[model samples]
Target chain A: MKAFEFLDEIGTVNTHTMVLDKGLGYAYVEDALKITGEYFDLLKYGWGTSILYDTEIIKAKNELYHSYDIKTYTGGTLFELANKQNKLGEYFEELDNLGFDAVEVSDGSTVIDPDIRENAIKQAKENGFYTLSEIGKKNPEKDHAYTTEQRIELINKDISNGSDMVIIEGRESGKNIGIYDEKGNVKTDEMTQIHENTPNEKVLWEAPQKNQQVELILKLGNNVNLGNINSNEIISLETLRRGLRGDTLGKIQK
Target chain B: MKAFEFLDEIGTVNTHTMVLDKGLGYAYVEDALKITGEYFDLLKYGWGTSILYDTEIIKAKNELYHSYDIKTYTGGTLFELANKQNKLGEYFEELDNLGFDAVEVSDGSTVIDPDIRENAIKQAKENGFYTLSEIGKKNPEKDHAYTTEQRIELINKDISNGSDMVIIEGRESGKNIGIYDEKGNVKTDEMTQIHENTPNEKVLWEAPQKNQQVELILKLGNNVNLGNINSNEIISLETLRRGLRGDTLGKIQK
Candidate 1:
C-alpha cells in the first residue's frame, strides 16, 4: 500500500501510457522497466534514436519490453526519415529484424503531401505491424503553418489508410508544436476542435507536461491516451488519470 | 570545435555536471554513458534507488562510470534513512561492497541533529568515500524553519567536519525547497546570502529547473557546480554553460 492511502479514491482507469525512450541502453531499459513495467504499456524509442543504436541492443530491448507485455516501437521521426528518404522498404525490413511490435509514421519533420502520407500508412498496414502515424512538424514556424482543418483532414486520412492510432505531434519538448503554445500551454480552441473532428478513441495526445496532461484528462475524461511521456512520469501520469494527483484530484470521473 | 563557437566566449569554465542513474543496468549505463559521459563528473543513484538494484549491477555501473572517469554516489536521502535507522555503518559497508568511490550525506527527507550530521560527514571521510552532504529538509514546512544563518552554519560545519562538498537541497522537483519558490523560481535574496556566507567552491547547489540553473550560473559564473541534473539535460546544460543556448547565450563569461 502507498504511504498516504487515506487520500486515495476508488477507480480502475485503464490508461495507455506511452513512455519516450530517447536512446536508453538495454540495461537501463531493463532496470527501469522492472520497476515500472506494470504501470506502462507502450514505449516509443524517441525520435531517430533507434537508428543510432546497435541492432543487437535494439533487438534485446524489444525482447525485454515484450516479456513484460509492453509493446515497443520507433518514434515517428524515424518513420518520416524512412519515407522522406524513400527507404520505407528497408525500414520495414529493419523493423522486422528488430522485433518491433509496432511502428510510428509521422510527417513531424518533413513535408509529405497528404496523398503520399496516406499511401505510407496503407503500406504500413500491409506489413503486419500496428501503425501509429503522427501529424505535425518539428519547427515552430512550419508547425504553426498547419491549421486545425488541415490536422483533422490528416488524422482522417491516416485512419482511412489503416493507422491503428493517430498521434498528435508534441515532440519531446511539447511546446510550440501542434496544440501547444510557446509557453507549453494548450490552445484549447484547437484542441477541442481536433478532439471533436477525430474519433477520440483512436487518438493519442502527446502531452509531455504535467499541466497539459491534467488539462487533457480534465477535458477528455480519465481514459484518454497520452504519449511522449517521460520514462519517470509513467506512474505519475497514471496517478493523474486516476485522480491520485493534486491537479486532477476529485475532478476526473471513474 | 562546437558548431556555434562564434556565439560563445570560451574560457576555463571547469563545470561539474552530475547526472542521476537510478537503478540502471550495466549495459544501459555503458550505452547512455557513450552519449553523455563527456558532460558529467558525478553520477547519483537517485534517492534510495541503490537499495533496489542487485549488488553486482551496482558494482558494474560504478565500474562503467569509472571507465568514463565519472565518480558514482548514492542520493543524500538514502544516507539520511540509513542514519535515521541506525544502519549507518551497514550503509558504508554496502557502499564499499558496491565499489562506489563517492557518497552523499544529506538530511533532506529526515532530521539529524547538527552534531550527528557532522559526525556522519567525518565517518564517511574515515571510510575513504569522497563525501558530499546536503542541507535543507525535504518537507517544505520543516525546510522553511531553517534561517539563512542556520544554513550558513550548516554549510561551514559540513565543510569543516570533513565534507568534500556541501549541497543546498533543491529536491528532485526543485520547487518550494531551498532557494526555490512555489513557481520553481529562485529566491534571489536567500540564494545570494547563502553564497555570501559560504565558500562557493565547496558548495553544489541543486538547481534542477532550467531557470534556477540559469539564475545560479548568472550569479556564480559558468564554472559553478550544479547537481541533481537529469540524464537528458547534460548536453542542454553544457550548451547553457558555454552560452550556446538562447537563455544564457552571450550572457555567460565562457
Candidate 2:
C-alpha cells in the first residue's frame, strides 16, 4: 500500500524504473537504497563508470542491487568500448567476476556492423548474461538518420538474436535522438509506430525528463519500462506512475 | 589545491554554491561532502523535509555539514510552517537544538505581511543565525505580479531587515519566478535592474538548472553566489564555474 492508496484504488502500479548509479559508493548506495530500493527494478552503473570504480565496490554494489531483486548491468558504452578494443571476451570475464547478472550491448558511441551487433547479442547470451541491446547513435544527426522502419528492423533483429530487452536510446539528454525531438518532447507518431512494431515489455525507453515519463505513462500505461532515470527521480517517477503526483493524478486508473 | 589538480592550471577557484539536501542521512552527507565539499559553502534541507526526518538525524547531518565549513539551514517553508502555527519561538529553539546555524524566512507558499516578514528576519538575526530571506511567490502568476522594481525593493528591504542573504525564489524549478522566465531563461533586463538596485553580496539567486548556473556565472562572474543547487550537480557546476564545461568554456576568465 502507498501513502496515497485511496487515489490508486485499483492498485495495480509497478513502475520499472532503472536508476543510473553514476560513481556512487557502496555505503551511499545502501543508505539511498533504504529510502528508494522498492521503487526500482534495475540498477545501471552509467556508461563506463563501473570500469572506473574499484572491482570490490562494483561487486558490492551488484550484491546490494540483487538484494532488492534489482537486476544489475554495466552501461552499454562499456560493452561497446570493450568490443571496439576486441576485448569482448575479457569484458565478459570481468563482468561475470564482478557478479553483474545483465549487460547492455550498444553501438551508441561506436560503429559495430549490423551483423556484429547481432552476433554480440548472441555472444552475451552464450556468456550466460541477460542482454539489453540498445539502438540509435549518441550523436543526434546519426540517430535521426535511421527511419522508423530501420529502427524496427534493428529491434526485431536484436530480439531474434536473444536480447532480453531492447532500449530505445535517450542518451541521458533524451533530446534529438530516436523518438524525442530537440526540445526533449516525444514525437508521438514515431512512438506509436515503434510500439506497434516492438513488444512493450521487451522495450525500455530512456526518459530522463519528467514530461517524457508522464506522456509515456499516459500513452503506454504505468508499467512502461523507463531507463537512464536519475537517482533522485526514482520516488517521483513511481509517484507519477501511481497517480500520486499532480501531473498524472486523474489520468491513470488505479 | 583541489584533488584533481591537473584540471586546475590557475591553482584553484572560489565558488559559493548552496546545495539542497532535502532529506539526506548523515552517511550520505559525509560521503557527498568528501566528493564535492570544496565546491560549496552552505547546505539547505529543502522545504519542510526536516520535519519528515528525526531530530537526531538532522543534528548529525548539521554536524557533518559544519565539519566541512558548510553552514546548514532549514528551508523557508519549514520556518513559515512554524510561524503559521504560532510556534515560531519553539521552532527557533528546535533549529538551535538541531545545530542549525542559519535560517531562511520566506512567504513563498503562505502570505505573510511585510512587517511580519521583516520581524522574522530581525528575530533570526537576534537569535544569532545567519539569515537568508527570499523574494517572489511560488505560484507563477503571483510571482509575475512582482515587477522587477518591486522585487528590487523587496531585496533591499530584506537586507535592511537584517537578512544575511536575500534569495530570488526559483522554487527548485528556476522558472517564471524572480528574474527567470517560464522556460527557465533569465530575464537579463530585470537581472541588470536588480543588480543596479541591490547591494551585490546580500543577494543570492536560486539557480537549480545548469543552464541557469552557466548564465549566472557568465553574466555575474565565477564568484557569484548561487543557491538551491541539486546535490548531484555540485562537481558539474564547479567545473562549469571554472570554464571546464562547453557551455561556459572560454566565456569567463580571471
* Global lDDT of each candidate: 0.80, 0.81
| Residue-by-residue lDDT tens digits, candidate 1, B129-184 | 98988888876898999998899998998898989988888877799888999889
Q: Give the per-residue lDDT digits (tens) of candidate 2, residues B1-254.
A: 44576654443466567998754556777777888887888888766455544455567778888998999897776676567667788778778877999999988777898998988889899999998988877767878888888888889988888899888888777877788888999999988888778888778889999888888888888888899999889989887887887998888776
10 residues in a row with least lDDT, candidate 2 chain B: B7-16
- DockQ in order: 0.06, 0.08
lDDT of each residue in A138-248, candidate 2, tens digit only: 998888789999999889889988999999999888888888999999999999999998888899999999889989999989889999998877756765675544356
- Model 1 lDDT tens row, A1-254: 22112222445477677889877767667777755676677889988788888888889999999999888898877887778788999998889999998988887778778787777788778998888888888888998988999999989878888998899989888898999999899999999999998998889999999889989999988888899998877756765676543345446765
Best by lDDT: 2
Tell me, by TM-score, which candidate is best. 2
